[model samples]
Target: MVAKMAACTGSKDGQDSILEPLCFPEQPASSTSAPSLQGPSVELLVCLFCPESVPLRQKDVLLKHLLLDHKLVIGDVRLIADLPKYMLYWRGRFLEQPVSDFCSVIKTNSTGPLEKQEDYFLLCDVLPEDRILRERLQQKRLEEVLEQQQLERDDSSFHRLCMFCSEEFTGNRSSLLNHMAREHSFSIGLPDNIVYCKQFLDTLQDKLDNLQCLYCEKTFRDKTTLKDHMRKKAHRRINASNREYDRFYVINYLELGKTWEEVQSEDDRELADDEDDDWSDWWAHPVSAVCLFCDHQSETMEQIYSHMKETHGFDLHQLRTELNLRFYQQVKLVNFIRRQIHQSRCYGCQETFECRDDVLRHLVAEGHVMTLPDASTWNQPQYYFPTYENDALLCTLSDSDEGENGETSHVEDVPVIAEDVSELRALKQSSVLNQLLKSRGCSS
Candidate 1:
């Protein structure tokens, strides 16, 4: 018996439409051909869109064909409903089934109403295998975007801002510290709350593209030009008066060769030594003086200057320019130490005492001596005089009456005198007898 029903269709109003019947031919009976060993063959879905009625065994392949060839989406409800016109047969059944019957069957199997695109696929049972994979990929992309946003937020949170000028900085702690110290004249010992700002550091980097002098605030095209300017202007000597403050930074530079604890131990040892012990010996020591640029050391300033010039192509001025920041800080510290040292007070402790002696006592008791060891020697003088032992010249000190008295005084081993010192006293004193005779109004 042949059973016929209207083909499924969809109207402009999104309602089902009845259409003419689509034919399905029955399998021919096997007479002369041998009976197949297999049971009833698996049914194939056929596309009516092709004149040949192309057969696809798998639903996924049919869906891909519909999408790729027919330009139809599998899961779309209206499209799926309208698809019966293009579906000659499904599972060996003619496409002449009632639209309501197909809808009813799908509604009976699925949990929800057939409203969404995925729901239509679920009803039709042609959902792709990689559909789940696509969803997981989309979900993974969303998670990655969220994680990147969170990291950006956290990074912004760590950025530091200047308290005084309300400027922003993007650099790390060291760069921020250098900026604060240089631009704002901000002390190194800032309050813990002060922070670096992202904006300021970025701006500072842009500004620094042109080499600028930190001391004179002059901008230069390159380092060579800056060096020339520094040499001609004598800008390196700008920190000469501030060497006391520079001394601390120099000490800090030395400390970089070793750990803080090690430097502290060395300082302790030095402090424990006797007062009469020549502190000049420490000046010749390796740890005491190190090159600002390369950490090279020597006994005297002249040797260090020579080393810097020969090895690093840096003269004294160039070396000083390189170490300008250290010199700047040193000047400030020296001034502070001088002020506090003479005031009979401890700057770190902020305690006042009656006399300098009492202040030293307090400093020793509170361990401030270790902290500001330079303060103890603030009263001492620092002198630099170059001596040449090889060159010598001799001159005699004589009374005017020496020739008349047939007596001559000769002196040997005197250094050559570059300038006249005829009015000055001789190195060797005249005899007291001659001086007494001269003073007593008697000729020697």
Candidate 2:
């Protein structure tokens, strides 16, 4: 009965009755059309305030845009919180990154699971502003340090502190020496402290190298040059008898309870007094005529002489010295003028003039006096010798005719040649003056 029933059930569809499967095997999906869990197709950095979006390529460029273009300050909590919402595409998806993760990566300085581009961008957004501020502060600090160092160097160069007394001094060695002598009674060559004394002496020698000529007030590089200048200019011969006259001594006006401010005010008053003098006008309108004695500009030789005598306090000795110096200077200037005369040029200005008269006019108008002494005076015999009655030496002019007649005729207050050294010796025995003259091969 069961076989008949099965046959009948199959017979209804028996002509094409094949056993049909209840379930079919599942077909694999096409790889090309499959959806991926990795997120979106394009990566972009979108602006929060505008519709502008930049390709997520470089972190720095994006950060610069945010800071400069959008005027955003990085590291703000609100901005960082809102950053993911503005990011149109992140990790190939729109707003796929969590705000916490994004902020964490932005704050980090190291590379990790996050893409390097995103990591750097985050770092740039958070740290650059602070970094720049710190760098600027460091640069300012460095500059301040350098300025302080320079100030210290300048102070050391201009001023020195006494190692023993800790007193600061701003003048030369002679001033320091005088201070030591006066304040401490310290003699430089004491046998008790010979080594220390020698060291101090060496320092003084070094300082003396930078001294000025006491007579001419001209600065020299070293003592040798100063000595040479004294010899060549015959300053020693002129001031021979007055040994202490030209010596440089530092006077401590401050010791008398006078302040530096008071001294400065007194100096200013003196300068004001000088400005009220006639020479101030002379200086204001500089003339071509320079003084032979001191390079002082004057309209005439008489004016020059007056200036030297009154302003410089020149004695007969100083006047004779200046006269001698002037003679040589005049000779040089005359030669220069002669050479330039043919070219119709003013020797002082070195500019071409219309004629010799024009040059002369320019020279005279500009106070360029180049007057030579009378030819008669050039050949006259002159002498400078100290008199026992006065500290200053007397200049005498000897009559040439009287000299030829074997009789010495003395002209009062004029430079003359002395025939008798015995007469000078009879007047005074100045060992210092004798040694000075002897060094210059002169018999005093």
* Candidate that would win on TM-score: 1
**Residue-level lDDT for 31 in candidate 2:** 23
lDDT of 1 by residue, 266-303 (tens): 75555665666766655441322233223245546556
Cα lDDT for residue 362, model 1?
Answer: 68
Clashes of 2: 18
Clashes of 1: 13
Residue runs of model 1 more than 4 Å from their true location after superposition: 1-158, 164-166, 174-293, 301-306, 309-444
TM-score of each: 0.16, 0.15
Against the true structure, candidate 2 reaches a TM-score of 0.15
Tens digit per residue, CA lDDT, model 2, 1-444:
000111111222112121211111122222222121122124666664456666654435666776667444345322231233334323232145443443334334355554443332332244453344434444543343334333322232334554335577763333344455556544442122121222334444444455655344567877678767866885432222332321111111222222233445575544666436655355452223332233244555456556755653434324334455333333433333333443455445455655555655666677544433343332222212111112110112112223457664455533455343564576556678887888999987
What do the candidate models score in CA lDDT, each in turn? 0.39, 0.39
Model 1 residue 404 lDDT? Answer: 48
Residue 155 displacement in candidate 2 (angstroms):
13
